[model samples]
Target chain A: MTAVLCRHFGLHHMDIAEDIASDTFLKASEHWALNGVPDNPTAWLYTVARNKAKDYFKRTAIFETKVRNEIIPESIENEGEFDYNGRIIADSQLAMIFAVCNPANPSESQICLALQILCGFSVEEIADAFLTKIETIRKRLQRGRKNLRNNSFQITTLNETDIRSRLPIVLRTLYLLFNEGYFSKTSSKQVRIELCSEAMRLTLLLTENTLTNTPQVNALLALMCFQSSRLDARTDIRGEAILFDEQDKSRWDQSLIQRGNYYLVNATDRQEVSKYHLEAGIAYWHTAPADDSKWTHILQLYNQLIVVEYSPITALNRVFAFAKVHGKDKAIVEAEKLGLEQNSYYHALLGYLYAQTAAAKSIAHYEQAIQLTKSPTEKRTWQKEITLLRQDKR
Target chain B: MKEFALIFRLTDISDFQPSPEQMQERMNWLGSIAARNQLVDKGNTLLPVPGSAKTVKPDNVVTDGPYTEIKEFISGYIVIKAATIEEAVVIAKENPIFKIGGSIEVREVLKRD
Candidate 1:
């Protein structure tokens, strides 16, 4: 709705777009509680958003200086008409995304702006997801918004050339968005699911358009679908993180896995093997039957993934697969070389790898993991691992 | 079966913004009542906004304005048919508003028949 509203008025005030979106929710909460939810809640929200957008424009903008001033009649209320058409909203969203993914902003700002602008997440929500301070997120959003406003990014239908150049950056933002959700440290399962779904929804918007539907986009979408399939099984009844091995396979959403396979196949017809393609293949293997070959395939994908886009998380994960394929000792040798000492997952992985041969080292690593993680559930889980390892020690 | 109206009250709604999941949760609770065929009438919200009530006395004066000063106000109501007050209270107990610290008052509706 903010995107649509920005489009409605020639895209002058981005901050007003955000404020209106927030106010629309406030109105809906007040109105719906008093009047009950309307038959078409989505339509209701859109209408409220439209009104609030106009209200915000009137209240906040300096009418004499804004783009609206040129066309404004005596009563500016009816000057700009909001188009609620699905295609137009998609176009506006694309514009908003491209504006956020502007090469000038740092990669972190790009992801943060995408979360705030494209995904309709509050700054606080983005902060919660990143496990960073709200003030830091606020400043990042301010900087991103400032960059966008200074650039005067217009909300127009993207041309083919613009789509061609910007689509990769947009896809990367969504990819990181999905990963942020998939690998969240937050204990709230609902928050994780919401973030992942929002990413998928925006990516689906891209896939719906012919100009933007590229192989890498499809691959990223496929990867998200595959990971989201396991969202439910990734947590236990108590909201603690469940190890991949212990999670129930039946709980994985088969439908999402099927959708992922479809997209992955769609991705293969294209020549370029982006990191998303590799990651999608890896995620697909996770849904496959766990056998020795599965580990081998996953290990191979991780090897390619590291080469494609080497990050600490990918290296850590690659080490896990290496452990599965070769012996634990060899994997441990590789893992220790990464030197991700501050990472809880690294410590936890080390704990898992050492459990069999070196119980004392395993317990020590679990204790380190417990200390490194901020999540209470993760701390408790590592504590439990230490207890189990102690029993094995005797 | 006796008809009962469950009135929902909230302390503050000025800043209440229900997320998609919370909206879905509330809808699920409403769906459950309808599924049991106990839902009689989805009642209207008595207070349009917080403190939107108007009172008129015998004289021509009227007293009503923003209830911003008040701590609580009726948000809405829903009517359900149940065999007894206990059953009505059980239905009221299931309202999702309570999850956010709101309360529900379930009362039997009197009909002159």
Candidate 2:
């Protein structure tokens, strides 16, 4: 609703749009506390926001005349101008995505802006998601908004070519958002779930649009659905992250798994393959009933993913699949070649692989892993593994 | 309920010009408290350092103010009604100044008999 209002008033009046939105919420809280929530809370908020905007315009005649002459058409002025429908709201949000992801701004700024403005993520929440300090997130948002204003960016539908060129950044932003939600180090599960749902919702918006409904988008959606299906099983009763093999399969959401499969099928319809396609394939294998054959298929998907988009994290994850497919000794040799010794996960994986044959080396790796990681939970897990290795040695 | 003044102390490291998002978040926090009728004063941000400031000394003598020797300075203050000092501390903790490493000193406002 705020995005729509900003679009209507022109992006230059973002401060005004934000003021009206905040006032609407303030009014809602004051009124709802006295008289229970209205039957149609959305409509109520929208009406209050519209009235606030109207009041602002009435108070500033020069600004009102400028808006009338420059932005709003004379003919449309009489047609319930403030009555924004669902379609307009969606388009406004879509335009907001493009506006945030403008090539002129840095990628980090774009993601931060989208998360805060479009997804309603607080500065602290965004900081947690990106593993950065709150001050950094604040600067990113400031620079992003300043760039938008300087560029005279406004919310409007983009041409097909522009959409095609800009779509990758949007997908990348959503991908990072989902990853943050899925593997958040923060204690709050609710925030993580909200992030995941927001990412999925925005991705769904892309899939719904004609210009953005590409193979990569479908594949990304499929990957998110598959990963989300296992969210319940990913954490233990005490909210600690559980290893994939130790998770209880019964807790997985079967309906979401089915939905993931549906999107995966759609993703494969095109001849062109993307990193998302490979990732979705890997995620699908994880949802499938675990067997020796499934591990082989997962390994193949990881290989394809690495070839398509090589990242240090992806390479590290690929080593786990390699360990599953090949013997531990062979996998250790391959992992050693990756030169990721500084990474805690790399040391952790090495410790696990070497625990059976090389007790002293495994203990050393576990200690290294504990030293490298800042996460208390991860350190505790490594300590427990080291204790077990000592017991085995005794 | 007692009124408490939340005095924000700005460290030298603090960002003088906070981003718009930071400003909005601070406003929203204060707005929520105000909606509940707990706010006594919305408060004001102080002028930047090395600016026009004066200190009135003994015998009506005036000098350039804000002791340059001090590393920390009083930036702003907001008064809110709370049932106890603990409640006031909780309110003070919500101020956005802490995000940039500034500190808030909560003091109870004494009432006249």
> What is the TM-score of each candidate's chain B when compared with the real chain B?
0.79, 0.82
Best by TM-score: 2
Q: What is the per-residue lDDT of model 1 for residues A1-394, given as tens digits with 9 covering 90 to 100? A: 7777776664456676667778888888999999999998878888888777666556545664485665443334534555677777788887778777888788889999888777778888889898899999999988877877777766666788988888888888888788888878887777788889989998988888888888888998899999999999999877788899999999999999999999998888556999889989999999999776898778767765664554777778887887787789988876875657998889999999999999999888998898888888889989998888887764
Name the regions of candidate 2 deviating beyond 4 angstroms.
Answer: A63-80, B1-113
For each model, chain A TM-score?
0.87, 0.92
Listed models, DockQ each: 0.01, 0.01
In candidate 1, list every pair of residues with a backbone clash. B51-B67
**Chain A TM-score, prediction 2:** 0.92
Best by lDDT: 2
TM-score on alpha carbons, each prediction = 0.69, 0.72
Query: What is each predicted model's overall lDDT from 0 to 1?
Result: 0.79, 0.80
